[model samples]
Target: MSAAADPAAATGPRALAHPGREEIRIEDVLHALADPVRLRIVRRLSGAGEGQACSRFDLPVSKSTSTHHFRVLRESGVIHQIYRGTAKVSCLRQEDLDALFPGLLDSVLRAADHQARRLGEDGHVQRTDG
Candidate 1:
């Protein structure tokens, strides 16, 4: 059926495309998490219990650049995004990821935390609780 003709699609905000869990490849996920900006986004989302609005992040990059990062994360199956009213909300696909590649997310998050402390960036330590 046409998306417009579907009841859920008619009432809900426009849907964003995401790879099915089975289609999520490890290479794409690793590549997406490789970028510092994208890794930061993932780390932030991991700590947030609920989906966070895109604007809630205070990334040190141009708005367009931030948008590109989010798009990469979404396309890589690292996170899921949905439009809510005028805002877009994002959250990690933790369960799917954990099931697909056990301990992968946790390992990456730990590494990020280590690097953050090692670099002494702001001297502020953040927890990677997911």
Candidate 2:
């Protein structure tokens, strides 16, 4: 049978390039998250329990710009992407990130939340009290 017809060749999604966990760098990760758009993407992915399809985000930019943001995130190892059928699903590399930079992700998210609340952008301030 041809490769296309082979059962083994029919994996869930075609492989996409990503930096290995050990290959991730702090500077790259920070840079990737520096952009407002990318930061928003990361924030949304953090709350997405089962990850999210690329199309789900309603970014203000054009499609090409959106693609660029995702690419930066993927390359910097801030997020992981996999092809699910024709769509690319993305999720934060929380485990890897926490391992590499303890408390970093949480701190960033908390700061973002604080700023969001302070600016009244989302009008939702996460409570820190136990």
Candidate 3:
């Protein structure tokens, strides 16, 4: 059988979500992180405790892109998604991260930001105090 069709292959690194995790939308996570804008949003979100709203992030991308990024993040397990009226609130899955592997998300985001800044990318600021 093709690896995709094999249960054993399905249990590889890509299958390593939390024990009870419903399949985390891989496309969502990849699409979300694919954009420079969305990656910055995630970097900022990681510095916060939980639940940052849509308006709080200052993305240079257009509103449409912003919405798309949020949608991707929601579909991904990286962030918890919620709609509060017209505003969509997103928060890092802290408990989920701790359960899955400690410090992975924060370290990744921080390292990404640091690398981006070192390379002179403009969006790589320390997350602003909200």
When sorted by lDDT, best at the front, the candidate numbers are 1, 2, 3
Clashing pairs in 1: none
Clash count (model 2, backbone only): 0
lDDT of 1 by residue, 5-112 (tens): 234532454887777778889999999999999999999999998789999999999999999999999888898887778898898888888888999999999999
- On residues 1-130, what C-alpha lDDT tens digit does candidate 2 reach at each position? 3212235533554866778778989999999988989999999999987669999999999999999999999889998887777888888888889888999989999998779876677556556675
Tell me the spans in candidate 2 whose CA falls farther than 4 Å from its real position.
1-13, 122-130
Q: Could you tell me how far off, in angstroms, the CA of residue 3 lies in candidate 1 after the best superposition?
A: 19
Which candidate tops lDDT? 1
Name the TM-score of candidate 2. Answer: 0.83
- Those runs of model 3 whose alpha carbons end farther than 4 Å from true positions after fitting are 1-20, 25-31, 101-103, 121-130
lDDT of 1 at 65: 97
Candidate 2, residue 69: how far the Cα is off, in Å: 0.2
| Top of the candidates by TM-score | 1
lDDT string, candidate 3, 20-69, tens digits: 23465445555666777777888888777667888988888888988877
